[model samples]
Target: MELFGTEGYVNVSVKKICDEAGLTQRYFYESFPDRVNLLAAVYQHCVDIARSATIAAATEVIDRAGVADGPVPAAVIPILAEEALGGFINSLVEDPRRARVILIEVVGVAPEIEKLRLGAIHDWADLIAGFASNGRPTTPKQKLAAIGLVGAITQLLVDWQMALTDPINEQAGPDLFQVDSVHEVVTEMFVATYDKIFG
Candidate 1:
């Protein structure tokens, strides 16, 4: 995972991975058939981390709102969005290697890998849709709105990551790296979409 994040999956070889882990090729093959398999595993691991963080953060907000066992009020939607999205974003920002593997390295790796990535995105969208509906069955429109919100957040993170890599973005200021800024933007998007869909 670290290697894929720092050196990139395309550049890293099985030999390097084995060397880093002090394992022989025979042992490595025992676990994974090829490097692509390993990359998929690593990507899943990163997604799990981010997903867990998002859920946990949102749960905390719900608990604090005294709505753990009840429907979440519409008024709390913005705060929920801020903390939930912040959790997902901070989990990656705190570890750029994970961020790279997720947002950059995982792109166009292979058909199977891309499928896995898209599945993860849908999983996140489903999660948000559940939150919006308070665990009720979501309508197709709600699901679509949730997916759109997730896509927007994903693009925002991609752009933020790009700015971090480009020297010219340095002049854009520290807001690029601030989780608060990201949370605010995402929260507004979520709130507006929620109003349109569920009001």
Candidate 2:
């Protein structure tokens, strides 16, 4: 996670990671067949951490906001977004190494790397869809609505990336995902798009 985020795929070396871990070349090879595999592991582990944190933060925000239904919880949306966005920023914040490794190095180089990067986005989309529907949808309308809402949340992240500096919640807008119980406009995009699709 550290090196991958710092130096990126191209610059990171297995020798460096082994040195950091205080192990021999033999040990590094024993654990990973290639640098790419090692980097993939790092990416997966960090994303897992971020994903779990996002879910927990969302739940807590929802509970704190006293939001049970209507249009997905506002507090939770921002919290989830923060967790997702924060995880990456935490790695890259003021650290050029991580930025080069993660955000710069591997992107568009390989499909596998792209998969790792987008995994969390897809998961978050599912969550947004669930919030829009309050559960798995039983009807086409509901499912469509859920997907639309999820798309909104996913796109919010893409736009956030474009800003290049603002954190997710800040770039996404405090009101980015709020609608009904949500306080974010992006969330409202979920609501509006969902309704429009269903209608």
Candidate 3:
């Protein structure tokens, strides 16, 4: 992760990775067939951490709000959304190398990697959709909207990490990388859109 995070996939070498791990190339080869394989493993690990944390955050909200016996409380939706978003955002912020590897460096790396990325996106979208609908069946429009929202958020974070969000380039007036402002805006947008889709 550190190697790929620092030098990126194209620039990273097996020697560097092994050196960083204080292991032999033989050991790396024993575990991973190639660099892409190593990248896949790292990506999967990071995704698992992120997914688990986000789910835990949502579960905490559900437990705290005491929504086990009935439909999720309407007021709890924003809290859940915020908590889930915070979990995901903090995980990336805590280890931006993982974020760059998953969000930026993995782009166009391999068909399998791209497929994995899309699959992860859809998995997250499914979770958001289910939560938005309060476990009710989602309409086609709602499902599509959920997917779109996921895509938007992913791109937003990607741009933020890549320094693509400058004041002149964005119509939002300020750089979107301002973490707190971005978090607040994203939460508001998500809550509003989720309600519109499922309310």
Candidate 4:
């Protein structure tokens, strides 16, 4: 994961990976058929981390609000959205390697990997739609909206990650990297979508 995140999947060799892990090629092959399989596992790990972080953050908010059993109150939705989005974004921002693997390295891989990536996106959409619907069965429109929102958020984060590497964006200052700004924008977008779909 570290090698893929830092050196990129295309650039890193299996020998290098084995050297990094102090493992033999035999051992590596025992676990994964090839580098792509390892990349898939790493990608899935990153996705799980982000999803777990988001759920944990939202659960904390809900627990604190004392609304564990019932639907989350509409009044707390914005705060919930902010914390949840922050958790998701911060998981990546705090680990640039993970961010690069997820947002950059994972793109245009093999067809199977692409399918896995799409499945991850739909899983995220299901999660967001579930939250927006407050555990209710999401309508097709709600599911579609959630998928669109997830795509937008993914692209926004990718742009943000790119800006971090682009020297021209340096003048944009520290605020550009602040997770709060990203969270605010996404939270507003999410809340508005929630209102449109479930208000």
Using lDDT as the measure, the top candidate is 1
lDDT of 4 by residue, 68-169 (tens): 998999998998888899889989988999899888888998888899899999999998887779888889999999999999899877777777765246
| Ten-residue stretch with the least lDDT total in model 4 | 166-175
lDDT of each: 0.88, 0.54, 0.82, 0.87
Preferred candidate (TM-score higher): 2 or 3: 3
Worst 10 residues of 2 by lDDT: 174-183
Candidate 2, residues 77-102, lDDT tens digits: the string is: 54554443344334433444444444
RMSD from true fold, candidate 3: 2.5
Q: Which runs of model 2 end up more than 4 angstroms from their true locations?
A: 65-106, 138-188, 194-199
* Model 4 quality (TM-score): 0.93
Compute each candidate's TM-score over C-alphas: 0.93, 0.59, 0.90, 0.93
Where is model 1 more than 4 Å wrong at Cα? 167-179
CA deviation > 4 Å runs, candidate 3? 164-174
Clashing pairs in 4: none
Give the RMSD in angstroms, all C-alphas superposed, for model 2.
7.1
CA lDDT, candidate 1, residue 136:
83
Model 2 residue 169 CA deviation in Å: 24
